[model samples]
Target chain A: MERPHNFSAGPCILPLEVFEKASQSVIDLDNSGLSILEISHRSTAFVGIIEKARELALQHLNLQDKGYKALFLQGGASMQFLMTAYNLLEKKAGYLDTGTWASNAIKEANNFGKTEVLASSKSSNYNYIPKDFLVPEGLDYLHYTSNNTIYGTQMKTFPKKENTPLVCDMSSDIFSRQLDYSQFDLIYAGAQKNMGPAGATLIVVKEDILGKVSRAIPSMMDYQLMIKKESMFNTPPVFSIYVSMLNLEWLSRNGGVPSIEKKNKAKADLIYSEIDRNPLFKGFTALEDRSMMNATFSLKDEQLGPKFDKLWKASHINGLNGHRSVGGYRASMYNALTLDSVKVLVDVMKNFEKTA
Target chain B: MERPHNFSAGPCILPLEVFEKASQSVIDLDNSGLSILEISHRSTAFVGIIEKARELALQHLNLQDKGYKALFLQGGASMQFLMTAYNLLEKKAGYLDTGTWASNAIKEANNFGKTEVLASSKSSNYNYIPKDFLVPEGLDYLHYTSNNTIYGTQMKTFPKKENTPLVCDMSSDIFSRQLDYSQFDLIYAGAQKNMGPAGATLIVVKEDILGKVSRAIPSMMDYQLMIKKESMFNTPPVFSIYVSMLNLEWLSRNGGVPSIEKKNKAKADLIYSEIDRNPLFKGFTALEDRSMMNATFSLKDEQLGPKFDKLWKASHINGLNGHRSVGGYRASMYNALTLDSVKVLVDVMKNFEKTA
Candidate 1:
C-alpha cells in the first residue's frame, strides 16, 4: 500500500529513508550484534553518533565554527520555554507575541523575570506578523517564534538589534529555509518537525550568551552545563538523537538547507496557488505573512465541508484539519514532504471545485 | 552472529520482541499507512497508544484505580529530581543519600528548600544501604534511591514513617522486583533501564501529594498540570512512548512484575554465587543489600584484569566494565537480560580463574 501524504503540523513527515535506516538500526546497529536501543550513551559508538548529529545540525544551518554549540536535549521545545528563561532571563527579556507557542514562551519567561512584549499580532488573531516593532535597549534577549504552525504565519524577516541577543523558537521551520543563521544567539527546535522524531530537541546556542543569569539554574535546565558535558548531561534520549542524526545525514546528502529551501518554495507555491484559484476555498492568515511550512485555509461554503473532507480522506490525505484555534484545514509541507504530495492535494482541491 | 549479553548500567537492554515490534512499527503502525514518527500527539491512534502505556504501567504496579496517575514524561529522572522538589517541597524534605544519583537529587532539592540528610552510605563509597535512618516529624517528604546502578546497592526494605509522603527514584530497579508500590506516594524512573528506551520517563504520583508546595512550578515541571493535560501538555516523545507501551505489553504478557522478579532472583543468585566461590572475585556492595538488577564485583588480583576482560569479550559479553568511580566489572542484569547471558558471564569468569 502507498503511504499517505502526511500533513500533520509538527511531528509531520520525514524522509522514508530515515525510517528505513532507523528501523534497521533498531534491530542491529551496523551488525554489532546489539540493538541501538541497548547501546550505552557513554559508549564511543554513541558518542560519535551524537557528535556527528551536532556537527550536521550546525553545518545545515551554516553556523559551524561560529561560536555556537548544538545540543540534543530532551523535554521538547516546551522545556526550552522555561530553560531559555532560566539560563538567560536575569533582569528582563523581550518577546514578540505571535501565536499560541509564542504566548507560551512569554508565560514561561515571565516566571523568571520581567518579559516585555516587543510586538504582537494577537489583535489580528495572529493572521499577520508584527513588523517594524520598536526595539527596546538593555533587554537581556529578544525572543520570537520563527514560524507559527497553528496560525500559518512565518517571520520573513527577524528583529535585528545590537547589544540585545536574538533568541528564536524555530520548532516548526528550522531547516526548511536559509537565512542569516548567525543573527540569533540561541535557536531551539523540537525534533518532531523537520529534525526526526519527538523526544529530542536541538538547541544551538552561542557560548557567550550563557553565564549571564543570576538565578540558581537546575543542572538539567542549565545550558552551560549541558554544553560542557557535550549534551550528555544525563543519558540523553538515545534513540531520538540517533534517528535525528540519521535525518541530519539525510539533509546533508540532499544538498543541505539551500536545496531544500527551493523545494519547499515550490511545494508552497503549488498549494497556495490552488487555494487562491479555487472559488470554494479561501486562505487563512495574511497573504504577505503566509507560512511556507504550514498553509492554513478554509472552504468558503461551510455546508460543503463534509464533501471536501471526504474527498481529502479518499485521496489518502492525513492531518489536513486545522487547529481548534483556527477551524479549517492545514497542509503542512515540511522538507521531507515531497512536491508530488502537494500536487495530490491540489488535484483534490481542483476536482472538489468542479463537483461543488 | 550471536547477540551479546548487554549489561550497560542504564539505557540498557530491553526485550528482543519489543525491539522487533518497534522496528516494524517505525515503518508502518498498525497498517495505518503513517510512520509512527509522523503521527501527531493529538491523533486518535497516538492517544490510544499513550493511554495504553499509562494503563499498563499502572496495572503492572498494581496501582490501578488507586488515585495514582502514571505519566510518560520527558527529561529523564534528572528532571524529576528538581520537579519532585518543585511540587512537593513546602518547607523541608528528608533524603537518604545512597549513591551518586541520590546525592544529586538532594543537591537539586536543596535549591528549592531545606533538605536534611537522614542517612548516607557515601562514607563507605556507597557499598551499603543506610538502614534504620531516623525520620523526623514535620517533613514534607522522604526521598531515596531504590537502586543505585553505579554502586550496585538496592534498598531491600524501604523507610516507613507515618504521614510522610515516600518518594523513590526507581530509575534502575522499577518493575524488576515486586514490592508494596502503594507505600510510596511518588515514583519516577527513566525508561532506558528495564522499561524501554532512553527518552521517556515514567512518573507515578499519588494525586493527593501534589499542590502542597507554595513555590510556583514551571508548567513543564508542574506535575498537576501534566496530569490534567494527560501528559500531552506539549508534543510528547511519541516514538519512545510507543516503544515503551510495546515493552509494557511484553512485560504484562510475561506475567508482569512478580514473574520477572523470580527470574531476576535466579540470575542474581547464579552470578553472586560465582563471585563468592571464585578466588579472584569479590562483591562490591554489602551482601544483604546487593542489587538484583546489577551485580558489581571486581577481581582480587589486579593483574588478571586483562585476562578476564578478554574472556568476557570472547564470550559475547558487553558493558561488563564498571563505572569509573569503582574500577571493576559490573554485570547489569536488567529485566530483559536472559539467564543464559548470566551463565555465559559466569563461564567466562570460571575460565579466567583457571587460565590465570
Candidate 2:
C-alpha cells in the first residue's frame, strides 16, 4: 500500500525504512525471538542500542569532544520545562516567550524560582519572533524555543549573551539544520518531530552547566545523574529510543544534518512559494521569521476553505490542517518528508486555484 | 520461527495477537493512513483509543460504576513512585516494605514528608510478605507493593485499614488475578508486565482520593489535573498506550481477570510442584508467600549450573536467568503465558534432573 504524505506537527513523519525495520522488530528484534517491546531494558542487547544512540547523536552534532553529553529520557519536552529549571535556575532565569511552548517553560520555571520574560511575541499573537531585546545580567540562563510548531516561526539567529548560559527547546528543528551546538549549555527535544516517537526526549547538556542549583533534583529529571548513569536512570523508554536510533542511523546514512537541511529547505520553499504566489492563500508567519519546518497559512478567501481542504485530502496529504489558534493550514515539512511530496501539495494548490 | 517462552520480570511477554496488530499499526493504523507512531495524540483516532483503554480498564476491574478513574500516563512506575508521594504524602504516610520496589517507593516518599515503616520483610531478604502488621491510624495512606518481582513473593491478602487510604504498586502482576478493586484508593502499574510495553503506566485512582495534599504537585504528577484533562495534560506515550489498549482488548476477549487467574494458578502450581519434587532445584520464596506470577528457584547442586542453563536454552526458553542479586532463575508467568509453555519449562527441568 502506498503511504500518504504526512505533515503532522508532532509525532511527525518518519523515514519509511525506519518504520519497516521497527515493524519487523516489534515482531522479533534481530532474531532474538522476542519483540523489541518485550525485551528487558536492562538486557545487554538494549543497553548497546541506547549507548549507540547517544554516541551517534553526539557524533552527528559534531559535539563529541565538546563537553556535551547526549541522553534519552522520558516525559517529553513538557517535563523538561520544569526539569531545566530544577537543574539550572537558582535565583532567576530569563525566557524568550516566542510561542506557547516557550511560555509554558516560563510558567513551569516560575514554580522553581523567579522567571522573567525578557522578550515576547505574544503581543502579536506569536506571528513573528521578537528581535530587539537585551539579555539581562546575572540571570542563570536564557531559554528559548528554536522553532515554534503552532506559530510557524523559527529563531534563525540565536541571542548572544555573556556570563549567562543558553538553553533551547529544539523540539521541531534540532537536526533539520546545522549549527554550532557548543553555543548552548543545554538543549532538549521530544523525539516525536525530527527524531522518532513521542515517548522519549533527547537531552544534550554540558557537564559544567549542572550541579549549581541548590534544590534536590528528582533523579528522573537530573541531567547530571542521567549523564552519570548513561540515561538508564529509570527504565528509559526502550521502544522510542530504539526507533530513534534507527532514525538517527538513517539521518547519518543520508549525509546527516546538512543534507537533510537542504531537503527541508527545498520542501519549505516549494510550499511557501505556493502560499505566496497563489491568490487564495496567505502565510500566517512573517517572512523573515518563517519556519523551515512548519509552513502555517490560511486561505485569503474564506469560502474556499471546504474546497481547499477537500483538494489536499484528495491529494493524500495528511495533517495539513493548521493549529486551531491560527485557524489555517500547517504543512509541517520535517526531515523525512520528500520534496516530491511538497511538490504534490504545491500542485494541489495550483489545481485548486484553477478550479476554485 | 517458534516464539520463545519469555519470562522477563518486566517489559515481559505480550499476547501474540497484540504484537501482530501493534506491528501493523506501526505501518498504518486502522487504515487511517498514518503510522500509529506519527499520528497526533489529539487526533480523534488516538483519543478514541485512549478513551476505550480507560473504559476497558474499568470494565475489566469491575470498577466502572465504582467511582474509579483510569489513566494512561507516561514515565512508567518509577515516576508514580514519586508522584504517589507528591500527591498524597502531605504530612506522613505508612509504608509496608516487602521488597526492592516497595523500599524504593519509601525512599522517594521520604523527600516529600515523614514516613513510617509499618512492616518490612528485609530481615529475610524479602523472601516472604510481612503479614502480622497493622495499618496504623492517623496516616495519610498505607503504601505497599502487591508483588515483589525480585523476591518472588506476593501479598495474597492486603492489610485491613479503616481510615487510611490504600495505595499499591502492582507493576509485576496487574491483570494476572482478580481482587477487591474497591479496597484500594490508588493503584499504579508499569504496563510492560501484563499490559503491553515499557513506556506507559496504568493508573486507577478514586476521584475522592486526590486534592488532600497541600504541596504544589507538578502538573504532570497531579492526579486532579490529570483527571480534569483526561490524561491529555501533555503528549502521552502514544505508541505504548495504543499497544496497551490492544493488549487490554485481548485480555477482555480471553475472559478477564478471573479466568486468567485460573490459568495463572495452574502454571504456578505446575512449576512449583516440579521444584519441590525434582530434588535438583528448590523454590526461593516460602510456600505460603510464593507468587503465582514469578516462581523463583535455585539449583540445589550449584555444580550443575551450566548444564541446567544449556538445557533450558535448548528448549527455547528466554529470560529465565535471574537478577544478579538473586543467583537463581525466575520464571515470570504473566497473563500471556500459556499452560503448554509452562509444561515445556517443567519438562526441561525434569530432563535436567534425570541427566544430572
Candidate 3:
C-alpha cells in the first residue's frame, strides 16, 4: 500500500528516502553488523554519526562560522523551556506570548526570573500574531515563538531589539522556510517536526552568551556544559539523532532550506487558495497571520461536516482534522509534504462542494 | 551478514526478533501505512504502545498487584540521577558507593540534600561489592547501583533496610537475571542494556512514596506528575519506547526473566570457567562479586595482548575490549547473548592459549 499524505502536527511527515535510510540503519548501521539501536554511543561508528550530525546541522542552518553551536540533545522542546530559563534568565527576560508554546515558555521562565509578558494573543485566542509589542531595554533576553503550532499563526517579521539577546522557539517551523538563522542568540526545535524523530531536540546556541547566570544549573539542564562536551553530555537520544542526521542529509541532497521553502510556499498557496475559493470552506486564521505549515480552516456549513470528512478520508488524507481547541481542519504542509498531495486535498475540497 | 556477538557494556545486544520488529516499525507500524517516526505521539496507536510498554514492564517484573507503576521516560538514567534526589531527598539520604555510576548518583543527590556514603568499594577500585554496610534509621532513602558496568561487579545479596526506602540504578543489568524486584522502592534503568535503546529509561516506583519533598519539582523531572500523566508528561522518546516495548515483548515470549536467567547463568559460567582454567587470562572482579552480565578480565601476559585481540576479532567477538580505565577486556553477556556465543568466546581463549 502506498503511504498516505500525513499532516500530523508533529512527529509528522518526513522524507521517504530518510525513512528508508533510518529503517536500514536500525537493522545494520555502517555494516558494523549491529543494529544502530544496539551499538554503543561511544563506538567509533556512532561517534562519527553524532559528529556528522552536528556538523550537518550547523552547515544546513548556516551557523558554522557564526559563533553558534548546534547540539542534538534529549527531552524535546519542553525540556528546552526550562533549560533556556535555567541558563539565560538571570535578572529578567521579556516574552511575547503569541500562542500555547510561547505562553508555556513564559510560564517556565517565570520559575527562574522576572518574565514580563511584552505582548499576548490570548485576548483573541491567538488567532493572530501579537504585533505592536515592546522589546524592552534592560532585559537579559527577549523570547518568542516563531510559529504557533496549535493556533496556526506565525510571525511574518521579527521585531528589532537593540542590545538585547533574542531567543526563538522554532519548534514548528525550523527548516520549513528560509530565514536569517544567525539573528537569534538561541533557537531550539524538537526533531519530530521537520528534523527527525521525537526524542532529540536540535538546539542552536551562541557560545558567548552563556555563564551569565548566578545559579548553579543542573548538569543535565546546563547549556554551557552541553556545548563544552559537544552534546555528548550524557548518552544522547542516539536513534533519534541518527534518524535526524539521515533527514538532514536528505535535505542537503535535495537543495537546502531555500529550495524546500519554495516547494513549501507552492503547497501552502494551493491549500490557502482552495480555502478562499471554495464556497463550503472558510479559514480560521487571519490572512496576514496564517501559518504556511499549518493552514487552519472550517466548513461554511457545519451540517455538511460528515460529507466533507468522508470525502477527505476517501481521498486518503490523514491528520487533516484540526486540533481539538480549534475543531475544524488543519492541513500541515511541512518540508516533506508534496505539492501533489496539496492538490489532492484541494481536489477533495472542490469535489465536496459539487456534491453538496 | 549476521549480527555479531555484540558484547558492548550498554546499548548492548538485543534479541534478533526485537531488532526485526523495530526495523519494520521504523518503516511502517501496525500497517498504519505511516512510519512510526512520522506519526503523532498522541495518536491512539502510539498511546497504546506506551500503555503496553508500561504494562509489560510491570507484568514481567511481577509488579502488577504490588502497588508499583512502571514509567518509560526520556533523558536516560542520568536525568534520573538528579530527579531521584529532587523528588525523594528531603533532608538526608544514604548511598552505597559501589562504582562510577553509584558515585555519580551520590554526587547529584548531594545537591538536593545531605548524602551519606554508607558504604564504598572504591578502596579496591570497585572490583568487589561492599558487604558491610548499615542502613541508618534516619535517612530519607538508600541508593545503590545494582550492577557496576565499569568495574564488572554485581550485588548478589541486598541489605534488608527496615523503614528505609531502597533506590537501585539497575541500568546495565535490569532483566538479565531473576531477582526479587519488588524489594526496591525505586528502581531506575537506562534501557540500553538488557532492554532496548539509549533514549528511554525504565523507572519502577512504589506509588505510595512520592510528594514528600517541599521543592517545586520541574515538570519533566517530577515522578509523581509523570506517574499521574502515565509518563506522557511531554513528547516522550517514542522510537526508543516502542523499541523497548518490542524488546519487552520478545522477553515475555522467550520464557521471561526466570528462563532468561538460566540461560544467562549458563553463558556467564561458560566464560568464567574458561577464565579460571586459561593461564593466559585472569578475571578482574572478586569471585563472590563477579557479575553475570559483564565479565571483566585482563590478559595474564600483557605482552600477549596483541595475539589475543587478533584471536577474538577472528572469532567475531565484538566489544570485548574493556573500559579504558580497566585496560583489559570485558565480555558483557547480557540476556540476548546465547550460551553458544559464550562457548565461541571460550573456544577463542583456548585457541589463543595454544598459539601462545
* Top DockQ model: 1
CA shift of A327, model 3, Å? 1.3
Q: For each candidate, what TM-score against the reference? A: 0.99, 0.98, 0.98
- Steric clash pairs (candidate 2): none
Q: Write the per-residue lDDT of candidate 3 for residues B1-356, one digit (tens) a residue.
A: 96687888878888888888888888889898989898888899999999999999888888888999999888878889998999999999999899987888887787788999988988888899888877878788888898999888999888967888889999988877878888999999998898788899999999888988898877777899899988877788888999888989999998999999999888888899999999888999999999999999999889998888888898788898999878799999988888888888999988888889
Better of 1 and 2 by lDDT: 1
Scanning candidate 1 chain B in windows of ten residues, the lowest lDDT window is B1-10
Docking class of 1: high
lDDT of 1 by residue, A97-197 (tens): 99999999999998999999988988878999999799888999999899999999999998678989999999999999999999999999999999989
Please compute DockQ, using alpha carbons, for every candidate against the native two-chain complex. 0.87, 0.73, 0.77
Q: Each model: TM-score of chain B?
A: 0.99, 0.99, 0.98
The interface root mean square deviation of candidate 3 comes to: 1.1
**Predictions: Cα RMSD each:** 0.8, 1.2, 1.3
Candidate 2 stretches greater than 4 Å from native: none
Per-candidate clashes come to 0, 0, 0
Model 2 complex DockQ against the native: 0.73
